[model samples]
Target: MPYWRLSAYYFCYFAFVGAFSPYFTLYLKALSFSATDIAVLMSLMQVMRVLAPNLWGWLAEHLGVRLPIVRLSALMSLAGFSVFFFTDSFAGIFLGMALMSFFWSASLPLIESVTFAHLGTQGHRYGSVRAWGSVGFIVAVIGLGVVLDWLPIMAVLWGTASVLASIFLCSLAVPEAVRPLAHSASASLGDTLRRPEVKALLGACFLMSAAHGAFYVFFSILLVDHGYGKAMVGGLWALGVVSEILVFMFMPRLMRHYSLRAILLFAFSCAVLRFALTGWGVASAALVAFAQVLHGATFGAYHAAAIAAVNRWFAGRLQARGQALYGSLSFGAGGMLGGLVSGLGWETIGPAWTFTLGSGFALAGLLWLVWGWQPGLGEDGTDRPDGGGR
Candidate 1:
């Protein structure tokens, strides 16, 4: 298993995210786009994920190969993003974002399936390998932040495009994993989705992503409005991921001691506190830093546990689709809703209230998880007859 190569892919892939997620909106702002317009553009990433991942997953499954599809997606996404260099008009930007997003969204889920397949029985080490991505994020976020202070905002375009090229390069080096044989009596995808625990898991994931909408769309802008510098904005984003890296490093120990359900519950609890502090505590630097630290629990631990759950629940032939479905519902559907709602509410309800609403979404997810999930469903699904474990 070319572990370092896979790690390199994750690093490059998330480096693009680190560059784009926090700074791209700021770039849009520099172009004098309104809050509504920026929101619509940013939401395109999530909207395309809703459709693209499932479509790409199906194709990969049909072809019985993932690496080729991953390579194609990476090439297409880079091509799609190039349109940004030539056009600043809203219509052109919108088209570019849509095309970029459709292809960009296809890579992660398929790669995740590949990664897990390579891991085989060593799935607990996923965090250690995945931690490189966080390191990449920290590098890009802080580096770009400092650069933006000196260079023009167009530097964001250049930096992101450079990373996208790296992603394609890395994709070329990752060898495909052997696909597992499908069992004749394996439960259909529809049957798997019908399970109560699966429903609760996906629902909670959706709401959790929704709860983060404001953070992704406006947290940097929020800090800037309150007199923070661009470099500081990058530092804060890096600080959150730094803590996330710690969580990922320790995740093997965490998995040994805690149930996936327990980790998820704690993560949701932190999300409530994190978003609230981010919204209401902007004036207090200490409070904001503390909130950022909670990112370990909210995103680092939460995502590790949630994706692990998806991997366990959706086994055998359904693996790729399961990952895609999880992405579509949670990050795609949920994030789109969060982005759109925050955009519409940013001016009307104000930033504080807008983020508080995010807290509400997290609270809803926490409650749903607690009420809907049964205890003692082991990670390998040993507790239930259907092998449905939490």
Candidate 2:
């Protein structure tokens, strides 16, 4: 498949998330639901993701037909999320979210494998392509927030469904990618797990991403409470992603000289600072905007590094599974836990305390990477590291 095709597809898919993340809880709040209920509902997606990626990745690895799985899941997701239009009852929303989450989580790990395959040795371009998804997110969130000010908030679901429908078409078109393979799957899984570096890499991702739990669940609401308008909400989000895009554009050069571990280390440091500042001001528009810029390093750089690490560690049959492990542990398990904790924590302890908790998570990740995982095996690109593939 063409790079633009895959990028556009991912962009559309994530745009749905952009719309959902900022406004979904607000929609529930409008219905008079409690904070706990809102958190549970918002967190259902992460819960579903915890195991779904591995299940789908296993299928793709064994069957070697990622596109088929991607398309099937996309259809299921569309059918699932579309139900939100008909009702606002807790049960209705619960079922709809459950179905969508179960299906939606299946796509990313598989897509990451496909993306790296297409990028070949220049896998650093992964960020530039992936950043388009961030762009799509910015466009959707900003546009939909304004739309909601004038329209029924539930319209977000219908609009998201349409974008998801486009993603389904792209799923059908994305070509199968070639992954390095060994014959037996069981041995590959075992070998990858036994690698010390794999363990450390997974640990680092989990810690850093756990810190984002607060931001995802409450950042917009926090802004709204501080007297920011809907348009400002979108502008702030767009600025963060704009910074992410800039980082992605220069990523290939960074990877050329710096180790993946080094990039990730820097991302973790930025995460610490970013969350600290976020937890501190929130009332100061300038401070909040500056914190958002750090998003480029925290999420953008961290993701590029993690994906590259997964690509190097997993050979052939283990490729999809490697990415799946990262998703399940980090975005899936970590995201769910973070959202659940923050959802209630935000209400109980307020923004500062909640964000402080997030900062701790990021700091834990930074320390692990700095002290435990050493990627100093090569400096001139002539040698392969012990925990990596060539």
Candidate 3:
């Protein structure tokens, strides 16, 4: 299955995220862009995620191949990102981010489909293979933080570009899999989306990611505003992912013992608390640390659970589209809304209230999930105990 090669792809892919997520805004700040401008620029990526994945997914399904599309997307993203080196104007930067992020967002869902196809019946091992991505994230966050302290913020451009290049290179080595899905006579993608449970799941995912927009957009800026150093900010970012890595390590055990619904609910609960602590507890390192630890639930466990549900629900020809729809609805639509509103909120109300708004989104998502489940249904909306959704 070329497991290490797949792992390498994950590592490089998320290394790009780790670099861009924690430090890119700081880079924008160095360019003297306003909060709104930065928010718009960042949200542009999510906006692309909203549209790009579906397009690429449809193409993959049509072509009956995934790796070639992934390779093309990675290459385009890398080429697009290189534009950052030549321009600092808001218009140029905006165009570059838009072009690059469109392709960057296109790759993950396809790769995920490929990875799961390779895993076949061993889906539980997804966490173990995926954990290296967290490792890469930690390395990038910590290393870039130190470099930011030592070098200029512009160095982030070079660092992120380097990782994008690596992503393209790694995509080249991942062999394609041709796992034919067992089709059902009556099942279709539209039917799956129409199911009440599916709607609820996607809704919850959207709000959950929306709640994260503030943290992704402003966590570093918040810390810096409160007198934290770049290196410490980097360390804190790494700390959260380290906590996430621990959760990933134990994910198989956790999945065996709990329903996906329960895991998601728990993640939402942690999100409610995490954002609040991050917003209101900046002065207390211990409180902040406590909040960071919740990342184990908020992202790590939640994502694994969500992916499992999607896999179970979207079998056969709809697999790639299923993952793409999930990404678009959650990270795309949800994250874009989160980024836009948080920017306006941060500008008008301050970080405390802004993140408080985020907590509200998480709480809302939690409630939405609870409301979605029928009184006696399982994860797949079946009435059997073995369904494990209840």
Candidate 4:
């Protein structure tokens, strides 16, 4: 099944995230960019996701292939990012981010579809495969943080470029997944979207991403503002991912014991607590660390279950678009809203209040799910009233 090859793609893909997410804001801040400017610039990644993935997904489906498109997207992402080396103006950086993100956003959703295609019936093992990406994230985040301590901030640009190049190289090794033939009698994509459960699921996913806006855009800044060193910041980021890795390793067992709905409910509940602790408890290192540990549930378990649900519901030729829609609505639309609102409020409402606001969003999602979602099955191959199985 080319497991390592698939894993390598995830590794390189998220390695770039590790480098970019934790440090890029620091880089912009070093360059004298305003908090608002940094927020807008960072939000470009999510903004492109709103449009790019569906476009690329449609193209891949049309061509009856995915790997070739993924390769092209990686190559273009590297090319687009290189623009940063030659320009520093706000407009120039904006253009570079937009161009890079448009193509960059295309890769993950398609690759997710590919991975599931390869997994077939053994899909519960997805977390074990996905755990490699978390490993890559820890490596890049910690390594770059340590390097940035001694080196100038330009080192961030160089480090990011190196990982982006690695992504293109890794893309060359991932073979395409075999496409299943469409049955003419099957239900259409419209029919699937029409289901009340699908609408509620997507809505909840959007809110979850929105709730994470402050952490992604300003968490490092918040720590640094509180006198935490850059290396320490990296370690904290790594700590969260370490817990995430543990969750991924055990996800197969988790899938066996709990339904996707239950996992998501638990995850949303943790998100509320995690963000609240992070916002109000930044002064206490132990409190912050405890909050980071909750990442195992908030992002790790939540994402594994959500994607699995999407895969189950979407089925057949709709797979690529289904994954795309999940990315677009959740990470793309939801993240963009979070970044923008957090940016606008970070200075006025302050970090604590901004994060408390995030907690509010998570609470909304938890309530929405509890009210809108119904139980399906238990992992024991029996229907249960509480929604128990994968």
Worst window of 10 by summed lDDT in candidate 4? 381-390
On residues 90-171, what C-alpha lDDT tens digit does candidate 4 reach at each position?
9999999999999999999999999998987788889988999999999999999999999999999999999999999999
Residue pairs of candidate 2 with colliding backbone atoms: 180-316, 181-316
Give residue 294's error in model 2 in angstroms. Answer: 0.5
Worst 10 residues of 2 by lDDT: 377-386
Q: List the residue pairs that clash in candidate 3.
A: 379-389
Off by over 4 Å in 2: 181-187, 375-390
Compared with the true structure, all predictions reach lDDT values of: 0.92, 0.82, 0.89, 0.90
Candidate 1 lDDT score at position 316: 79
How well does each candidate superpose onto the true structure, as a TM-score?
A: 0.98, 0.94, 0.96, 0.96
lDDT of 3 by residue, 1-390 (tens): 789999999899889989999999999998999999989999998999999999999999998888998999999998889989999999999899999989989999999999888888778888988998999999999999999999988899999999999998999999988765554453678877877667888999999989999999999999999899999999999889999999999999988887888888899999999999999999987888889989989999989989878877777678899999999999999999999999999889999999999999999999998999553344542532123221
* Winning model by TM-score: 1
Best by lDDT: 1
Once superposed on the true structure, which residue ranges of model 4 sit more than 4 Å away at CA? Answer: 377-390
Q: Please give, for residues 238-279, the per-residue lDDT of candidate 2 as tens digits.
A: 888888888888888988888888888899988889987888
Model 3 alpha-carbon drift over 4 Å, by segment? 375-390
Instruction: Rate residue 334 of model 4 by lDDT.
Output: 92
